[model samples]
Target: MATAYWKGANTKTGGGFWSSGHTPTLIAAFLYFDLAFMVWVLLGPLAPAISKALALTPAEKGFMVATPTLAGALLRVVNGLLVDRIGPKRSGAISQLIVIGGLLSAYLLGVDSFGGTIALGVILGFAGASFAIALPLASRWYPPDHQGKAMGVAGMGNSGTVLASLFAPGLAKLFGWNTVLGLACIPLAIVFVIYMAMAKDAPGRPAPKSLSEYLHPLKSADAWWLMGFYSVTFGGFVGLAASLPIYFTDRFGLTPITAGYCTAACVFAGSLVRPIGGALADSIGGIKMLIGVFIVAALALAAVSIAPTVGSALAFFVVAMLALGVGNGSVFQLVPQRFGAEIGVMTGLVGMAGGIGGFYLASSLGLAKQWTGSFAPGFLIFAALALVALVSVFVVKSQWRRSWGAAEGVRI
Candidate 1:
């Protein structure tokens, strides 16, 4: 019975007030994550434009789009170390500067060919590393009961990708893609100034730990589980965000602007639902919420795999992305519960997994299209993995309730 599975799961422990003091850090983290996400996923909407300019084949397009995701995965570990050592504020500023420099170099110097775009994508990975910096930055300020709400608010910065999808193609049409890249640096520069001036590391933050201690969470099985779970949720959300422009254009013969609009709608659905997901998890249980999320997402993916109409396919994608967004929120809500002491490091480790998952999905869709001339196989494969997550959650939930959920001041 559902009741049996969720026994003691509804239990709440400590209650934390959302006083006005925590607002700036939360807003700063959101801005950092949002603008970074905008820049991180820029290549997706720009892929069609760059492909036309550079004469990139389908596989080349996929590789270019997926490069940032994979590169971000590797850089996340390094940023995680910096976040642990130098603090999120400093680490984040350094990362923002690197990303800004890279963008300026690309804009002024120019990307003349496919290889240049790939190199540019690598620099864009710094934007993606904001994931490692922002979550821990926000998590440190709030208490456990407010963990879900706070992280969810920060994670909404992912809606930045929506801005990219909405505007990148049109601006590229009007001003040239290079100019768009140059213009992107402006918002980032402003954000960096704001973030530096406003965001601060928590007082009484733990002393910098050794490399081994920073990675100690990896020694736990639960850490691996969280990584796996986030790999799917965040992976699906971002992978689709990066790929949907191409998918809409290829599948439906839509223009880049129209496709961007479609992609933006889907991204908006996912981004808008995230905070609701976190709040829901806070009330019932993340374990239970994730179970529903995996199931809904798997079903949605499977349905989209065979969808015959543009409207039908998009409808499924909206549902799947919504579920994935909820899953992203639920996973983090549980993270602070199990590893509050290690949230900084865990955010990077788990965030790396999410980036890797996104890389795989984005690349696989291209490969699937190149090799098989259809995207159904990729959707089917991921649906199977979602089911794997669903089953894994069933086994893990009972144990979590009896252990972490039973703790006096932690919400499971």
Candidate 2:
């Protein structure tokens, strides 16, 4: 029954959002992206149980969770290229198979050591790279006027992290962390089958570009700026998503399940706001919305660094996540406006930066806890990065206004 709705998405096109684009592909992209993300950050929610079983050190836990983010960051570039060359539907199919196989193998073999977890993380990176595939698959189907909302809805799949936070720890506690890996494959396989059935490449995909042509977006300073901006917005969001469980367990002495619940609240807030952010950016302007995002994010993170109680910390984290979540939407809203032609690769490039940012934050928090006996420094430094993004966006606004005419209801 569900399959029929998706199979029929092509016939629904008419006038507005539903009519203007392929709803089936958009829904497929979201489900694929959502499930991939759930497992991509799966290690984070499982970290407490994994750490306890392995007797891992603080730094080891951080590195373990962070490995997927770094691997995902690098693979996104590869997926971006694949999307342009082979089409997003095929690219997504291949990625899904890799992830499912990787998890199934990990489950069958069992991961007992730090090294094994690291290997598993690299496999999860394939899931993370789904970012590059999912966005373009949906984005190409929509007209420019609907880019923000369309991308926002598709991109909202990042909310999958909330699912991990909500479930993994309890499952790990029940069946053991290793079993959790195998269990994850069930949903992933289900989504993969649905994705294959529902996802269709949009018409008029760009001809395969030379490798150099794909990298051309890198030559532009605007591209660099966008990458940097996303690094902070998405970086903060995902970094905390992966790290907060560890933080709660370590700092607050919360049970793993409780920590997971707390982390879910934080992730859910960030995910929920993502589409609203894009819509707001469309109404105002990406630049204007981003400027406010950076300011709020900076303040919130700074406050979090000094939060003394779990309640206070949760409040600060929620505020920071909200600002960062909105920033994620706003960044993409601008990405299509400026680089619509290169959206495929640009998504990879900017997404890579965001992943790198997540890697740094997640890893550094562990290092900070190990070295300084507090996670405060890591939070402070990232708070500083948010301020830097604020400045970068402010400086570029005038240039963007001069270059991009007021067209398509997308404010620069």
Candidate 3:
């Protein structure tokens, strides 16, 4: 199919188009991913207002924020498979349309009831699954040597949370939360149309994997290890991004606007730094970057646990987000090196792990607040988990190095 497309393009344009990079394709994919991410994280900015209005318990509040993440995780595998069957361009446009519908439905339902909020959250998660399609779409368009930068650029769409964190609360405050949600649909609708018009699958690539080949990676230990690493890195980044506004409001008595600003800073720092992280990984190696990121993240989380004032809390949050962002880049760096051919399936599994981790982190914070009347325990727990991940990374590093070298030498 890709060969056919390439031939068609060559015949039409006399080969000039083939020499140009796929910049338009990359841009369209990035926009699609960004919109999905914004919707995926809607609950974070709205949590304080929604919880207070509904009189929700802390655990309930946590679950409300986590529902979309859980749903998104489960949908990633389905989306990954669908991308091959339908192509990223079609899948992205359709997914965005679905997200627009979901946002509209949530706006109409009005987040007044616990069940209603959870249902809305599930719809938002469907939007988040767009990641499975967007990342691979961008990667396939680039040459192998450029995959890291391409993926990094495309993955920056995750920064969409920064916009949500920065503005959603203010919007909700100005127009009422429901109206703000209804407004989100406008962008989704526009982006959906633009993506459909511009995005296309890469030309001259192999057909997508067979069902059996796609399933084969599931039995590999390396795949699961990568998932575990991502669960700690990308997972931590997303979980914290989605939960920060609520955490600030609950712990510091901050207003919704103030909380949104703080969360925005954290998310923006992480998202903007992702490309840098990828570049650093290319230079210094993924294992070293992962080691440093884990250490920094653990210390930052511990610092947050003991932070006594809003300034101190914000400082720790920024540091933690930076570390997690770097770790996210390192994890993906190692992923393609280890699972090049199985990229789609492995992305689904690893992406799901990250989503599940976000769900766990959000729920745990809520549980700690409700059960113990403090968030310190939750912070400590996350720090401890980072420590475990650090150890796991070290244990796997030597094995991966040897295996990768042997495989490359054999290919040569």
- lDDT (CA) per prediction: 0.87, 0.90, 0.80
User: TM per model?
Assistant: 0.95, 0.96, 0.92
lDDT tens digits by residue: candidate 3, 137-169: 776665433445667778889899998998899
lDDT of 2 by residue, 19-82 (tens): 8788889999999999999999999999999999999999999999999999999999999999
Looking at candidate 1, the ten consecutive residues that score lowest on lDDT are 1-10
Model 1 over residues 1-412: C-alpha lDDT tens digits? 0011111221232444356225788889999999999999999999889889999878888889999998888788888888878889999999999999999999999998989999999999999989989988877777667778888999999899999999999999999988899999999999999998889877656668888898988888899999999999999999999999999898888999999999999999999888888888888889889999999999999999999988999999999999999999999989878876777788888999999999988999888989999888888898988999999998898888887778734556
Return whichever of 1 and 3 wins on TM-score: 1
Comparing 1 and 2 on TM-score, the stronger one: 2
Worst 10 residues of 2 by lDDT: 1-10
What lDDT would candidate 2 get against the real structure? Answer: 0.90
How far is each candidate from the true structure, as Cα RMSD in Å?
4.6, 4.4, 4.1
On a 0 to 1 TM-score scale, where does candidate 2 land against the true structure? 0.96
